[model samples]
Target: MARVVVDVMLKPEILDPQGQAVQRALPRLGFEGIADVRQGKRFELDLEGPADEAALARIREIAGTFLANTVIEDFVVRVEEPAEAASADNNAEEGAVR
Candidate 1:
């Protein structure tokens, strides 16, 4: 199984009304060291199968075609490996040292 972590953010030039409102409120609330706070979105997807070429391709297509707006927003996908893959990496390190 794979856990796909996606981050979607607005382009820098795009104005974020909600984030600006929050930024304005922070100073009144005495929260210091707060600069411009532009909010974005995070999505965690539980993928049923393995993370292979086809799966990665599908993820990119989905993000570009629907999830992320090509004009104003951009997205990045991070694929988390399965438990077995993690163990295999650990085992490889153990053997490499011996």
Candidate 2:
């Protein structure tokens, strides 16, 4: 199986109140040195076949049309390697921070 990831983020000009709230709390929690934070959304899709050019194009279309708000947000779609996907799954199962 192939894993496709879609990441949706607000446009740089858009204000991110949620991200700003986290950034402000980070300092209170003793995590320092971060200049800024922008919260976003991630979508993972498992495909039955290879992630080829055609599949990528379809994914991009889906991302642009359904996954992101084109007026205020942008999205990127990518194929995730099996190893990397496995690692991320393991981390989630173990309650590790991303």
Candidate 3:
């Protein structure tokens, strides 16, 4: 099955309190050298078929209408390679080295 990934993130002008909180906590938790953090949401949709142009268009509409607040957030929708294909590519790279 194909997969559609929707990434929703606040606009650069908007303040992200949740992200700030995490950033602050990270320092307290002994993590350092991080100057900034912006949190976002990711939605994974497993499709029964390929994510063609029409399907991508529909997903964009859905993302703009319901998933992201266009006024304050921006969203991106993309197709993801199947897990098997990705692993196969990785395996090929590994084999090529040896």
Candidate 4:
């Protein structure tokens, strides 16, 4: 199976109250030096086959039409490597850490 990731973010001109709230709280929680924060949404899709150009185009259309409001938001779609590859990478990292 192929994994497709869609990230939806508000336009630069749009105000993000939730993101602002998080930014404000970060200082109080002992985290600092963050200039700003913009919250966004993520959608992961598991497809039956590889993520080819056609699949990516279809996902882009879906993201623009259904996942994001084109007037106030923008979206990016990408394909992630298979879970087995990711797992192997994670295991390698763990081994290195130990």
Candidate 5:
């Protein structure tokens, strides 16, 4: 088993009005030193795999095919080994059970 973490964001050249709105709001909330802020989405998944290399390869495919847009957005993917993945899955499942 493997775990995949994915992050997706708009292209650099693309403008995020929502993010800009949040940035503008920050100053009023007494938060400073943040020159700018861009917002995006996060996804977490657990996938079965044959090996670390293969898992990462599959993760890349998943990101390109469904998790991210090759056009206006970019994605980052991370794959972890079975031990790590299983532990996290167990924790998540346990939480669900509760």
Candidate 6:
């Protein structure tokens, strides 16, 4: 399986109340070095197969249309690479299943 990661974040012009609240509380928590904070969402999707060019295009369309609000948010989509040992193990398991 392949993993698709989507990161959605509010546009700079938009007011992020949740993020602002966290930022305001940071100083009280003794995290004074931080200048600012912007909260975002991450979605990980496990696809049944490899993400080819067509699949990537479809994922991009999905991100733009469903994962993010174009008016006040932006989304980024990318294929996630498995860690080295995990990738090898997954490949080995697939070979055994075949």
Q: What are the TM-scores, per candidate, against the unseen true structure? A: 0.76, 0.84, 0.83, 0.83, 0.72, 0.81
Put down candidate 5 lDDT per residue, 49-95, tens digits, no spaces.
Answer: 44377777877898899888889889988655556544555455544
Enumerate residue pairs that collide in model 2: none
Clashes of 1: 0
lDDT of 1 by residue, 18-71 (tens): 889999999899998888998888887778988778888898898888888979
- Pull out the clashing pairs in model 1: none
Model 3: residues >4 Å from true position, as ranges?
Answer: 83-98
TM-score of structure candidate 6: 0.81
Off by over 4 Å in 4: 83-98
Say which candidate scores most in TM-score. 2
Q: Which stretches in model 1 have alpha-carbon errors above 4 Å?
A: 81-98
Which residue ranges in model 6 land beyond 4 Å of their true spot? 84-98
What TM-score does prediction 3 earn?
A: 0.83
Ten residues in sequence with the least summed lDDT for candidate 3: 89-98
Over the stretch 9-34, how does candidate 2's per-residue lDDT look in tens digits? 99999999999999999999999999
All candidates: CA RMSD (Å): 8.6, 3.6, 5.7, 4.6, 5.6, 7.8
Candidate 4 structure quality by residue, lDDT tens digits, 34-58: 9999999999988887899999999
Candidate 3 residues 23-98, lDDT tens each? 9999899999999999999998887878999999999999999999999999999998765435656455544422
lDDT of 1: 0.81
Each candidate: what lDDT? 0.81, 0.90, 0.89, 0.89, 0.77, 0.84
Name model 5 segments beyond 4 Å from true: 80-98
lDDT of 6 by residue, 1-98 (tens): 88889999999999999899999999998888877789999988888879888888988899899988889999888887676424555445544422
Pairs in clash, predicted candidate 3: none
Between which residue pairs do clashes occur in model 5? Answer: none
